[model samples]
Target: MPKLQGFEFWKTTLQEARYVVAPMVDQSELAWRLLCRRHGAQLCYTPMFHAQVFVRDANYRRENLYAEVCPEDRPLITQFCANDPEVFVQAGLLAQDHCDAIDLNLGCPQMIAKRGHYGVFLQDEWELLEKMVKLAHEKLSVPVTCKIRVFQDVERTVRFAQMLEKAGCQLLTVHGRTKDQKGAFTGMADWEHIKAVRKAVSIPVFANGNIHHLTDVEQCIQETGVHGVMSAEGNLHNPALFEGSSPPVWEMAEEYLEVVQQHPPCTLSFVRAHLFKLWHHTLQIHQDLREELAKVKSLEGLSEVSRQLRLRCQEEIAKEKEGAEERPRGDLPFPHWMCQPYVRPPPKVLVPNGQSQGSEETKTESHKRALEDSDGTPDSLSKNKQKKKARNPHKTFCLELKPKYMKCEQCGNPKGSKCVFDLCRACCKKKAYKEVADCPSHGLRFKTKADRQRVEEERAGAIGDQEPPDGSQGLPETHNTEQEVH
Candidate 1:
């Protein structure tokens, strides 16, 4: 059968999914996808796979997609991050049969993505992106899609979307934030940019960002006029976000565990992370349980911790019913036991005068300010650094206080302290190679002529020492006969 494209693929293959679970690293796995599907997520994306690794490593393929195939987790898209057009197409081809579509991840903004030269870092290279998407579209059995971060300018974003659409992108998921807007700087996403892209592109569009609840999902779809809304952090905290319900923490945790059991070999770390997000609020109130959750290694151990937390929450509920105790609701819209979205505090700006002048600063920023005010005093060091210095007072980070390095005898560069030849690494390497000697300290090895000759002599001696195969401790019978004939 011929593969569908554009709105046809979105409607026929994806069932026109309106609520999507965003592709998250190490968070969205088969079990989690199944749990979200049960709770009303219409579409899901696999965690972003490194395209080169996905192509090269069989273990990665099995662990991620092949090991367990759940029929319930349908309308799935496998996302890959790659800069090379051929490699991107190769990965998509490998994954195409398993999913409804293959999504090129052009939205990741982490440091890892920057170092790899893939993800949003490649957004400027429109030619490369076009080649990748076009090649995938030509080669894959399923449709090729792209998930991208918007450029700062809405017009540029619209142009980018149009470029991808022309290059044969069947669907596009626009994360409504610039590549720079990540981590502490992840402010509100600009729906206007997403709206512009949706207007410009002919393919089906999905908007991601600023989605915390079902209401936000509805609002995003209405404001941007996109076909769908994708949620990452919000979904992690509350899987039922699309269902417009905030269930209890234990309810989600237990259901997820049940799904994990049904879908054997779910990663322990993935399960632990999901539990941590689900129990985020309750853990804040019960710090002890939070520590237990972090320390626990086994699946049963994690389930046990969840059960203990449920008991504690039930006790709190009993107290509230009797009017015996009233807990303070600080910033939570719901009780700590219930699942809710975690709101990231805005990024803080550090001023030149050692005072935070912008939004509220994080603890690390406050510590930095304290250090700046102290003017290089030892007391200004962080607690951990101070403790380390206490153990060795000679140790210091101040450049002026550091001991001067000894120069090499042959070169002016810093020498290896234990060098037998008293030289820098390069100088030592040259001398070692010339002399056919080994310098253990500098990790240079060279076999001397004498050493080589000695090894050859040892090998010859061993050959001569070997007795006949008949077990006599003498020369071979043929050699003895030849000697007698002589």
Candidate 2:
């Protein structure tokens, strides 16, 4: 096959970018991108920016495209969501100097995209989509690529990939979900369809969806025959997904915080999203701590909350070692917190002739075996057991009392709740309350005696006569419900 447009440059990049960090809205900021690159991500996309916003709003360009692009951040793709060919070309030309390639985001399924008439909403306008890509190919100095959602009709999906290639897209990212498969309807990504798309196009294809672990990267490539794999939620939860080791969530959190601090001036909202994702699985179980972390505004406040959570996680691990039931190592993968988690069947490695090689043990199982092989006991298990047995009396007492310190004086519930793990009746009845319960600082609180009085005074001043307010809204809850698109 003759090369797709710009294949000369894209092919060189594909050789090293087998594992990519997907472009995410509000989440894929520079700080997080740098963090993912440190772990093993070879290619990273900036969050999907509206081309119109990038073109018209000087401040948006300065803020969103403001990251200090270092040599280590090479082969970056700046993705834009646009439906107009002329405006999009203008956006691409502006961005081409900063990135290796400019990507058209054709796969976002958010309601915002439908309202804006971009993303997957443009899928049916094949002629317009091609013109947009062709315009960028002709106008920009760098290569043009697109990330698109699949169609319900397999034939149409294949045809769409072929059209993009013919229209001068040098690289293609195929998200396995259709435009309608969003939010609660986002079922598993159909890799079989992705394989079909790969067969129909000459351009380098990257698969997205059902990728939540490091091993999933290799599995997606082997199963779909795509040149690369892309991750969003998986990398957000474990920025170390490409590193092939399941380090504890706090360790990952600490590493991310260090990178974020070094890259100063990161938006408070962006920093909060990364923090919640890194601790989502464990923190969900402790609503009190989750709520406290949400209210943090500065890096210092975030750092203190993270430190407290790390200590809490250590305590949980110790309790499990002493009396908790044997459970899977590491908290369940982030997807498990949603409905029943998708347990991927082992991927079949294929030989050159396309025959199935054989099924192999999953990465999780292999890791377990490796641990068991080391001195006949998993190192993590052995180490925890040794710590449980050998910890000094004073340290153990402090760890045990930490939770008590976080409890309220009057209600006896923690800072995240009014009742015991539930809200008190009066507070719950308030019309001002969003479903998330208040900590009810009135007449009760955590930490020092002075802390309780201070909270009580703040509540009195704020309440006066009107209903007490729910704290000023923090970062909105991130609903990364889709696999392929934003």
Candidate 3:
């Protein structure tokens, strides 16, 4: 049968989904997708799989997409990150049978994505992206789609979307942030860029980012004129965000755990991460349970910890009802026990006087600063580096505080302090082999070879000094003895 494309594919195969759960790395597993689907999610994407790995590794394919014959996970899209056109097509072919469409990931901005030379790193290479999408569209039975981060310039972003559409991309998901807008700098997504891309493309467009609630989804569609709205971090915190209800954290947590139970062999780490996001606000109030959640190893253990947390929250709720406690909601619109969006605090900016502008500093930042003050290291050092220095005070990372390293005479590399040849390990090995010498400091042993040679020489000399078996010192003496006997 001929494959569907563009609006026909969107309307028929996808049912014109408007509320989409974005493709998260480890978080959007089969169990989580099913849970979100039950809570009114119109569509979902499988976690982004490495194209090369997915093509070669059968276990990866089974564990991710073909874990079971899940009929409920319909109208799904399997996404992949790839830089090669052929490999991307191969992966798409492998995944196309299972999903309604195959999505090329051009939205990831993590350091891993950068190192792998895929994802947003390939955004500037328009030719490669075009070839990859076009090849997949030509080869696979399913429609080809792309999820991309916007360029800083709106015109360029719109042109990029248009190019994808021309290259056989049936659908496009435009995350309204540049590649650089990630981590702590993930300020706010620009709806203007998404709106522009929606205008430029003839295919179905999905607007991603800045969606924390169902209201945001409605507002985004109304503003951007896109067919759909996708959410990642917001969905993680509140799975029912699309349902237009902020359910209790325990309710979501327990339901997710139940869904996880149905999907056997679901990764414990993924389940743990989901629980952490669900109980993020509550964990702030009950820090002890947070530790327990992190330390849990099994699913039952996670459920038990969740149950304990539920009891604690119920007790707090009882107190609030009786007017015995006046718990402050702080910045949260609802109480901490309810599921809501986790608003990322803005990045702290440093003033000219070396003080941060924001009075509210994270615990990690404060710990890092305190460590720096005591260790005499610059505050510019990373938090991890500061923590490492605090753990091992004697270890010096500063070049000024480090002991002088002696250079090898033969090579410029650093030499062992106790090396007899005064050379690096490589140079020392060569010199030792040539001179029949031993360098114990460098673990290079040449003495055994020399000893074997000496033994062979001594054996040869001893054989030459030995008398004949007939007791004849010379040939003349042997001849005279024979004549006297005659």
Best by TM-score: 1
For 91-174, candidate 1 gives per-residue lDDT tens digits of 887887788899999999999999999899999999989988888889989999999999878888889999999999999999
Give the total clashing residue pairs for model 1: 0
State the local distance difference test value for candidate 3: 0.89
The CA lDDT of each predicted structure is 0.88, 0.75, 0.89
Q: What is the lDDT of residue 132 in candidate 1?
A: 88
Worst 10 residues of 3 by lDDT: 362-371
Task: List ranges where model 3 is wrong by over 4 Å.
Answer: 347-486
RMSD of every candidate to native, in Å, equals 6.8, 19.9, 11.5
Clashing pairs in 2: none
TM-score of each: 0.79, 0.67, 0.77
Over 1-486, each residue of candidate 2 has an lDDT whose tens digit, in order, gives 332354466567544478899999989888888888888898999999999989998788878885556666777999999999999998887787788889999999988999999999999999999899888888888788999999999999999999998998988999999887765456678898899999888778899999877777888889889888998877887787788766777777787788877877688888888878777766766788787887777888988888887887777668777998644545444322321122334434333544387653322121222342323232434555445535642333223344453543446545334343343444433422443333443433333455677899999977764643664344346745574386
* Ordered list by TM-score, greatest first: 1, 3, 2
